[model samples]
Target: MAFINGPVPEALDREVAATPAEFERDLRKAWPQGVRSDASLSLELNDGALRLTILLEPLEPRRIGLLTLPRLCARYRFEGGDERARTALLTRLDRAMQRGGG
Candidate 1:
C-alpha cells in the first residue's frame, strides 16, 4: 500500500477495545427471563474473530433418561472473512435476541 493514511486511530482503537465489555454488559441486561440466575454470558476476542457464549436455563424442567440438566448453552463464533461477514453475524445475533433466545 502507498501513503494515504495510517492504521486505525488511537481514539477509534480505544472505542473498539471497549466495545466487547459494553456489548457483554448490554447482553446480560437484556437476557431473557427464562435464563437461570446463575447463567452466564461472555465474549472472547481472537485475532479477527469474536466468540459469544450464552448459557441458558429452560423455562421448564426436562427429563432425559434418568438425568436432569439445569441449563443449555450455545457458543457462536463470528470470524470476519469479508466486510459483510461481521454485519451478517451481528444481524443474526440481533434477530436471535429479538426472538428471545434462552
Candidate 2:
C-alpha cells in the first residue's frame, strides 16, 4: 500500500469501551508525543517517520440493566508507511489496548 500522500489514506475506525482519557493514556504508552485536540489525537511512530491521526467521537453510553459502559468511535489514519509496518503498528496498538475479553 502507498503511504505519504499517495492514492488514499489507510484508515481504521473502531468503537471502543472507554473514556477519552483512558484511551489516551493507553495510546501514550506507545505514542508518547501524541497531540490531543478537543476530541482527537495525532500520533507518530519511528520518531515522526510515520503518522497516525486519531479522531474520537463520543457516543451515547450503553446501559446494561443497572450498569453503564462508555463508548467512543476512534478513527485512525495511517500515513507514510508500508503495509507491513502499518499493520504491525496497528497490531501492537490493538494488543496493548484490548482487555478483559473472553
lDDT of model 2, residue 67: 98
Model 1 segments more than 4 A misplaced: 1-40, 48-61, 75-79, 82-102
lDDT of 2 by residue, 1-102 (tens): 112232333886778888878777777775555545453344344524567777777799999999999998888788787776676667667666667665
Residue 76 accuracy (lDDT) in model 2: 79
Indicate the worst ten consecutive residues by lDDT in candidate 2: 1-10
Residue-wise lDDT of candidate 1 within 5-94, one digit each (tens)?
Answer: 333211111111112334455454454422222324434333244333333222233459997533323234444454354454445445
**Considering every candidate listed, which one attains the maximal lDDT?**
2
Model 2, C-alpha of 69: deviation from truth (Å): 0.3
lDDT of each: 0.35, 0.67
Highest-TM-score candidate: 2
TM-scores for the candidates:
0.25, 0.74
**Scored by Cα lDDT, where does model 1 land?**
0.35
What TM-score does structure 1 among the candidates reach? Answer: 0.25
Clashes of 1: 0
- Model 1 Cα displacement at 57 (Å)? 6.3
Clashing pairs for predicted structure model 1, backbone only: none
